[model samples]
Target chain A: MAAARKKETFWSEPISKVDLQRPAVVPSGTSIIDAVKEMKYNQIGCVLVVGADQKIIGLLSNGDLMHEYVGSTLPGDTPVDTIMTENPFTATPALTVQEALEIFHSNPFRHMPILNGEAIEGILSIRGLMVFISEHLPLEVMNLPPDSSLIATHAAGE
Target chain B: MEGLKEYLTRQDFVSSSEVRWCPGCGDYAVLNSVQNVLPQLGLPKEKFVFVSGIGCSSRFPYYLDTYGFHSIHGRAPTIATGVKVANPELSVWVVTGDGDGLSIGGNHLVHALRRNLDMNIILLNNRIYGLTKGQYSPTSRKGQITKTSPYGVLEEPLDPLRIALASEATFVGRAVDTDPKHITEVLVAGAEHKGTAFVEILQSCVIFNKNAWTEVSDRSCREDRLLYLEQGKPLIFGEKRNKGIILKGTKPVVVTIGEQGIKKKDLVVHDRHREDPVYAAMLTKMDYPDYPLPVGIFHAMEKPVYEVELVKQIKEVTALKGRRNLQGLLRGSEYWTVSNKGKTIKRSTGISSLANDESKVMDERIHALLKSTDPLTASLKNTIGKIFYDYDYKRSKMLSPRDSIASAIALFKAAKIECILVGDAKRLYGILSERDIIQNVVLTSVDRDRMPISSIMRPVYEIMDESNSIGDVINILSISGHRHVPIRLKDGGFGLVTIRQILRFIHDTVEQVEKKESEDK
Candidate 1:
């Protein structure tokens, strides 16, 4: 039965096949403001936190920053680690694409750090994964149900 | 036939002006497509006139090697109508953006389309105002984020195709900028249409609002998302051409071809030339995701072309009236010219000689003269102050610079006044009017709630002294292109003198003159 298996599907492929981007990383002691600037400059949705010895410590997403710093009394110089999610769910390079998708589907976080025995590889965003999959099955990518936002509820007039 | 060199080429349509649109902008593709299509139309390059309103897309006229008019915002349709009406032989084309065409220009566009003028109007809809730096435009999708709509747009977007169909546009089509070949085809078809041909191009402003038509323009999904309407083809779409749309009890339903015994004939046929636009209007509502966005001519019906009919009417009238000239109309048969030797005017002699004759005959002659003469001409020499008092003109209230534009607009709306003096009664600064708002504030990035009235107020250029005659007021008003003028009072203040007030004064004088003439009889 094992020998009868013809070809491996896209879901059974290694996580590396998804081509995860090199995650934007900042030192644990970096300021929240600096982290946000890095995220904006890199045009990424989140930044990964690393402690001394270059081990992944936490993950700071735009949503995390928005909920933690925005409209709050926290000073710009406040450390990012205070607001970041510690021990974030991570994937391994050896993990199958299906495993990564399952983690994203079950978890609330949008970004997952890819780790290779504490030596960081990259980050895998749910959107990035979806885009990769869409390239394979382009037709099914946009075959979504109607978005309510597209429909005009009221007359467009003054 | 003339030599091949005599015919125009695509190179002939390229202008010397440098294309200044942002790199990767959809307008570049559209411009190229238009240039390619024009040479194929077989018309003289000089006969084409491209009129545009204000926007990034409005810059199309400068890049095209033809007669072009970059008219004012939202007035391109009106100017294009005039261009077509005046020169029916010329092929007129109006280029406008979503903000320019669907917002302030909405009324003009509707009228122009409904009139069925022999012109082509291209509306480049990028969903956002790229010229104004990404403000929510009239076609921007609800919940779409922009500079002005940081929290996302609240109002529903206006569908340009639906509006055109509703306006009874003789030719209405849609095309995306990404597909240059398709756009060129649609444009050629539109140019060939005899009546008003309105095409809304789904363009992308790469810098401000990128991928605005991604659902329909993206190479990966375009085949599945866009339904290319052929003249007699059935409405079908999808990568495999398996999914088709069928009308079920007035609602369009997507069905599989072979799954439930549905065939190609069951799909809605493309009937663009159908007289009634009800079917075409339904196609406009079939947007992306739920259904394929229909492109190509959604509706095309033969109608009496405005310019052709107008020229015909003018010709018929001229034949009936024996071609009367302007000089003949201006100078009636009863004109009296006084000689240089101080001779008595012919008409004036009649008035004097009538006194010598019967009083009833004098009254009759005066009444006849009054009928022929303009009543306003007699009051033109009267001082503006006297006219103002005679007409009981109300003093226009002055607004300060500190007032918000919103408040100024409110004042204009509530008071139903054309203009307001932007200063106190003591010192004059400038004037803010509805015209100023329309020309400056509307469709611009100016925040009416935050910006002060002084920001848009025009400095008073034409000022008339209260002692100045009404004749002087008319001269100033005509030269300044303003409907109202500020009258400087002798008591160190200003008064608003309007053309309406002057006309009212003339009307009252005419009534009095007529009453006096009847009393004499």
Candidate 2:
């Protein structure tokens, strides 16, 4: 079984990939109520605020909505720019699940957006990563692999 | 301490928030111990403040009637620092769990101890993340399993008492949750200490992580496990006080009081106020099963608190140099004259200037992403875009190409889409569109350098996912200001679902309902 596993490399399997396309963005001036409505209609948990030339300026998460909009004394019509966490942590598509998990753990937020150049491709959540890990790796291998081993291997050659 | 009885009450110390911990949680015992000790301190309840980070034990502030703040995880120390600095008269107490304090908040806790901040920090070492449903905490013993650590933890566990002693906390102590009297006494002593007093409480997480410290808290605790330290008393424990710790060279050896010709003077005498931390750290390292676990104050010393010293320095500096106003400081900087002032220019003109300047364009893209409908997308784009655009191209040799690619993908995922426009600091690269997924290697045929997005004219931008809530989609769109988005499945597969499709669906559903209502009418 060990010899067979060694021969059948896990990396050789075609790992599923997320699309790396640019996503729609919202501007900072958008009202919290309008942003919340947009999120509700779009069925998403967060909105990214960008400037006119399509540079990401800040992030507004569901937590922000819960804390700043629903939980705050401010009117629902308050501008999203006021409560958004400016310059949020970001990651790229090529980042491994392990690297992503570390960032998520160390940082405050549960959800991090994937960036490609000037555009956003997708949002990665801790839950999503966990699901990915459970589906891809066996339960025994979950804690067996050191966190360092899970880091993205970029150096050339074995 | 004589008139302490009339000064405070349990009701005066309780806060308005309803306690939400599970029944029989160790937190209840610790809470009761704290309340029982508060009246003994001869201070008004209003003069006390509780700052707690996120955790089950961090809920201490909620149960306390005093002024308190339920701060973010691992930030109670910072908050406590501010509270102590603001009102030196007020007694500040920081309540944190093992996970909150020793794990995530270790940095803050160590610094707070090192600075000897005038406060009492109670680290409830429950060895699990009780609030988050029993994940392995920093103080969890090696080879312990939990929800997150389904297999035993491979990393070495942190010893809170040793860490405190190492950090030079003026007052360092350890107590157990089961011993209410001892816990209360230690709390009172910690409160009385003028400088930073750090105490570690070994509490059990009974529900999710049960029986973690069973060996230590078992019925044979007195006879077999505990090593209670008292000032000027010999290091002794056991039912008959027969066992005593004696120094053999540098290491401690357990010896009977009246056996092996070991004299009473040979036994180590407790000196908690010793300035040197070596002995205190050694005492803290004593663990159960192998060695008798040391409890009670290990180290207590006097040091100028960070808050007190900061306040004094601030006062002296302020008195010497007059406080400067914000407006004066802002206006003092060199000002530039512009040809056009207060006149709004066309959006096209703004873009033209931005296009000419690469840095300016990069800044604009960052701003656009930040203001996008999706906050996560905007945040991700902004963070990565700024790093890419602002990084010195001359020093680009140091850049990790893999990280760059990963960052780009992360940005795209954060945007909640499949299509992304890859760009260098100077200009846009090939558009990684959804249709480019020709047998998986996306954009495999397209030349990354030569292919401008104008060549790919099939409206390649696709809706990423439909399951995403309207709030999330809007947040992304608002942040990035893009018309289309790409959605994905739970399994990480691609599916295009746009904001326009959602709007259209809602419009159609509403129209259908309205028509039905009119027919019924």
Cα-based lDDT at residue B139, candidate 2: 78
Q: Which ranges in model 2 have alpha carbons more than 4 Å from their true place?
A: A1-158, B1-4, B15-18, B334-521
lDDT of 2 at B270: 97
For model 1, state the Cα shift of residue A50 in Å. 94
Candidate 1 residue lDDT tens string, A5-121: 222256577888786877788999998778876776665667888899788889987656545554357777889899999988887888886676666655557678888888788
Quote model 2's TM-score.
0.49
- Local accuracy of candidate 2 as per-residue lDDT tens digits, B17-127: 788888877788899899888888888767889999998888788788888899999999988988888898898999998888987889999998898877999998878
Best by lDDT: 1
TM-score of chain A of 2: 0.71
Candidate 1: residue B245 Cα off by (Å): 0.9
lDDT, candidate 1, residue B482? 63
